[model samples]
Target: MGDLLTFKAGKVRYDETTKRATPLAGKGLVTVAHHEEDATFVSLVWERRGPGAVDSHDGSEETEREELLLFPGDAQWVHCKKCTTGRVFALKFKSSGDRLLFWLQEDNGQAEPGTLSAADNEISAVLNSLLNVLEENDGNDIVMEDKTGENTAALEDTLSTTNTGISIPILSITDALPISSFVAHIRSLPEQALKPYYDLMPETFEHTRENLIKVIQTPQFFSSVDTLSSVFRDSAGIGSLVASQLGYPYQGEGIEGFLNGARESGLRESENDRVAKDQEDVMEE
Candidate 1:
């Protein structure tokens, strides 16, 4: 709720093919703010201008704007690109220290990564504070609500109305098997079968097979699977697969049936219009 944190702008080079960034020259102003209703989310805004362009200069207004929204446990490195100028900038957040890393790439394709330290004490302090808040609530649910009395709805009501379902067939299969049996079956699968999952995860695949099995066997993990399966069922495109595998194919009206129904309704409406016109002609006689 206090003053926003701002830092000087720096030169950034970005590679389209690799989606990486390298830091280049002078510093510019960057601003950071936390969402008023959601403490777990933060917003960062920055601008980059042509070389030697001052705030009061003619070309100063031509500065390119970039904005980013970050949540707890986001990936360490993120990049932003400017479509008009083809300029790319990258930021890497480190929780261990009071610094924000910047990167840009040179014309020759070498990456130059630079660190913005505590010399800008105000910005550094703000960044550190935001990181600390996120670390404190890393795996917890973040509920955003207005503190004022205007929002009186209960959390349950809000969740019920806003939640959408997307199903995961693999997770749903766990419902039919005993927990121990399910865990054993998953652990017995070939490493190749799990590679797709590990690749999708943000962290590197460093855990041993036994350790991974132990991690997934916990009640907390099962609860998360259930919640995710309930929230994302239809949107995940696994509903049909789930129904077919469970021996209960979906019988609801599909797109083709809905189109045929619409066609019949339109035909009836046209017939009624013709009958009304005939009645009007007879009345005129």
Candidate 2:
């Protein structure tokens, strides 16, 4: 075991073992342990269950109880065998060479940068597409971080407002969709219904309108939107059919609603305003 951290009563405390904190609070504990020199030949088996126990290469079920070493202030991402995906512990060695031991830290497990799940990827795409739509129309509008309930309605209201240089600070849309209503909507759907859209835009549910607006201002943004929309259109079937399958229910093509909303939101109108109409056509098909 490298190290463990526990939380108790809104406060974080450290300990070597559970016993040490038993007299007090065992909310969090970090254990530093390593195998002996003779056990160097032991195989490290990575498992999803429990602390990583040392095992013999001979396929022996017996787990070796390694000695816990003490040193240093704290451990960072020291590189372990199990730092593959998601949030992971950052570990460091207490000493080099024969004195090689390990320390572990509780991390969100994002060791690799730009790492995202399928859901995250799609949300980013939608946000990016919306950004392109916003940027094509020259204005001082900024994306806002809001989602659901009064906030969602507020966004609709703001988009419909007659203001110039409006900024929507949707810094929390993605994180906030887990409220009861949203969860209920998601749960009501068949797993397959959301797959196509999710596959196309893996991170849609995790986006903030603010970040979405920012990305569209990048170079050749319209082209990017066209490309993304084209893919959805060409793929057709479950691909372009995402409006009903994934997003909130609406009449006709939802792209029209988005365009009309964008227009009313006071963002600049595109020279080729037909782009929105074209996207609406894609959605209709």
- Highest lDDT: which candidate? 1
Which lDDT tens digits does candidate 2 get at residues 1-285?
A: 332222111011112222111111112232222323223211122212234322222233321221222222211221212212221122222121011112122332354522434543333333223222211211112121211101210111112235478764322222222122233454466656555434433253234322232223222333454554455434535332554554433333333433334344334344346678898899999
Provide the TM-score for each candidate, comma-separated: 0.31, 0.17
lDDT scores in order: 0.41, 0.28
User: Candidate 1 lDDT (Cα, whole model)?
Assistant: 0.41
Clashes within 3 Å, all models in order: 20, 33
Predicted candidate 1 versus true structure: per-residue lDDT over 112-177, tens digit per residue? 222222343334445656644322212111121221212211211111122268643343423434
Give candidate 1 regions above 4 Å deviation.
16-27, 36-40, 49-63, 73-126, 133-238, 241-285
